[model samples]
Target: MRIKRLVQKHPEEKTFWKNDQWFNVYVQVNEEKRPDYKSRLYGEFDRFGFEAEDKYASLAEDDEHNGWRLFRRFKMVLHNNKRLTKDVTVKDFCGKQMTAFPLFVMSIKYLREHLLQAVTTQKIGIEETDILYVLTVPAIWDDNAKRFMRDAAVDADIDPARLKLALEPECASIWCETLGTDVKGAVAIAGSQYMVVDLGGGTADVSVHERKPDGSLKEIMKASGGPWGGIFVDENYMKLLDRLYGEEALTDLRKTEMSDYFDIIREFEHKKRTVDIKNTKHVIVRLSVSLRDLANKYSKQSLEERIAALDSHKNAITPKGKDKLKVDWTVIQSWFKIPIDLLIQHIKTLLAEPKMKRVQTVILVGGFGESQYVQDRIRKEIPDDLKYTYGTNVFQYFDENKYPDDKKVWENGKWQVPFCFKVYVRVNEQVKVDQQMTKRSTPNSKISLTAVYRTTQEHPKYITDPGCELLGTIELENSTDIPFEQQRLETTFMFGDTELFVKTKNKTTGKEAYMTFECFT
Candidate 1:
């Protein structure tokens, strides 16, 4: 209902996924009130978790506050894999069999409930029918993947007619259109070609577009991307830690201190965004007590001893405090290398293509696009002539053209004949001529007329209907004010279920003539 009220208040605004993260839902709001629609609700994808039947059953007995295990990163995996069909079941953390389709449906339902609750709390007035949903998918997703998403939405009660699919980069391009000249400046100029780099949490999508004179975009090349994203960076970091602490120790820490592990990753995300590989001397990451103890036990060395042994020309890692560790620039750079290298390679491949040769600017957007290291790597690796800009939000550029209403405008009316016609005449001192034409038709019959003109020379003047589908011409014997020999007029007519008439008048003599025609199907 809130979605409906929002639609009623601002019909142009539609609901959309903020990004591939799937952690938040962004609803477009009226631009007059808030230029940026930061309005978001929590996504329910991670809310449902698997637990032992006995534990879940006992928890269900309470009917509230039941513990649910959290499932994360599965959305990306499911979307990327072709073998994971709607009917295939996956094991959750608790080893419960859950179909991927229902998980998506549950997520959609959670989103809908949150939207409705927001509307109710805000006291907006409307109904379910007024809301339209737009889902954004990676441009690289094939038709089957897109269809699966649509089917999930439909199974969740989203109307098929009201649902729309959009490409992530194109959505970012639309948002770029809303940027002010003071911000985007000449890059927003019409006819400029831009490569939209959507570096989100799970993937880095790239697309090229040329801005049209009308402010719309023409896609110059197909979109391309890979699994290299912020998540991969996090995974690489985790792998590094696993190597240093031993896989068993890290696994134990994850099982025993899941919250602390999440916090550690979250801190890495912040550092990943702010870390300056060019100037920063060192980067510090917080470590939990359990993790530190486990690492020391598995490696048979004190945390400080390990740091001293691993120190090298590139950089060094040392214990910052009881709960933190300092990593030198070299170590941090190595962690960023995996994803950043992939990203740079992707951009190079795109730029090397003949179609992308003329593209001078690259517009970076999405979560990972906000990384300074990523941006710096691009600047260093890309051609000097190429330009790139970064922004956190660019969804406003996504436009959805919905289907038009099918209502008719005119009412049935009785058949009534209107008389109208056209005529042509020529006058000279020696001769005068006049022509008139008319058509007779029945209700069930069709009529067509054709006329030909013959002359010694071609006619310079001709007339045609508004659609230019029918024409008439007049010819004379010679190019003279007064015809010396013969004059002819030719006309052609084709009629269908409508009636038509033409009228012509002689301005000098104030004489008028008429012609009529009809058609039936």
Candidate 2:
């Protein structure tokens, strides 16, 4: 007998909503409480609308941190008036039954508007012409994902054309580049060879890179992803709580007084992210309050007596959100063993493979990579002979894709050099070249200087394309010759390797050109 499972097709261009105005939109969704949160919440996003601001706020903080003084103010407003939920929602604000997406979208919308304001004033780093990259989960990808992205992008004042949506796996490559690790043919070097394991709340992604002598690095990025990271552990903690306190107890608390239950759960999550012990104690109290309130409503016991009973079972009622936590450390360690073991097994297999046996080091990165438990487990599993490095703040380099050849050189020195020099372009043989192209230009028009391109000997690895050399920038000796609008020097560096032609345009509009002597390897 043959069996069939359901499959969904990805959405095409119509997935995005359109208006008369032009805008670039980029959106990515992840599971709110899980890795698959964004997928489950897609339909709801249509009814409630996307909020780019909240997503930005959520991203700014690790988790549980609502942004800053602004967040505190918003929290107060939401707390004082539950009707604020109704204001934000198109439908009735049903307590406990309320979905997480609406709030998430609202937050994103708020954050994006704030960011837009700053951008208008030229306060933020994100420029009007910059393309926005929205991070999302791998599970809920398809037409729905595209729609959500476009919705969010439009709200963020970004043009949909300029917006690029990518999964975390693909973003890992960008992260490497943002950190100045992206290079061509870099895997051959010793210091440059290492795996980038991005273990975050909902997923874990891995990539490998090698450094090149020309100050660049190359990466071995994987294509597959799965549900393996922090959210699963959080679910485990929830299950444990349900087992001890009785699921009914939580149901009652959420139904009658959701804020109370949400407060406790939210605080517990905050503690987990912060690793704060005092917060853990508060979680115990919060849970105890719920238990006491439920007991008071059902039994003849006094609130004080119910509270006492809760304290007694506190050992069994584990708090995962905001507290130092009450669960056995050994149990927590064992709970994570499954995913940890999987990672270890994969690493072991990769190392055992004949091609990877020579590998000497591993680099740990991402949100979950910061977990003390994960670090300890990796340390205990790997051989002492192999080296390890942790990317303490990988998010800081999340946007890095343009990598120089040398990591050490880029990290240590901030020297300016003429990058346009040695840059080269190959014009199509069929393409016409005007030898006196500059002569036709106006007096204030830009002209190309003597281009200095990389020699085959200087970048041997890049010799795959023999004619592809580095191209240089044009220089105007006379200051008055440069016009205000023409101050920008634009040149297209052409390159081709028989099959296809490639061109890289360099626009030096406002920044001064760097002067440095050329060096050969």
- Which one is best on TM-score? 1
Question: Tens-digit lDDT track for model 2 on 336-386?
Answer: 777878877766665555555444445666776776667756655654321
The clash numbers for all candidates, in the given order, read 8, 63
Against the true structure, candidate 1 reaches a TM-score of: 0.58
Give the number of colliding residue pairs in candidate 1. Answer: 8
lDDT (tens digit, per residue) of candidate 1 on 60-165: 3455212243345556755577765776555554343444665666667667777878877887776777888888888767777788889988977799998999
Model 2 C-alpha RMSD to native: 25.3
Off by over 4 Å in 2: 1-114, 121-127, 130-157, 167-191, 213-217, 270-286, 295-325, 387-521
For residue 464, give model 2's deviation from the true position in Å: 44
lDDT of 1: 0.56
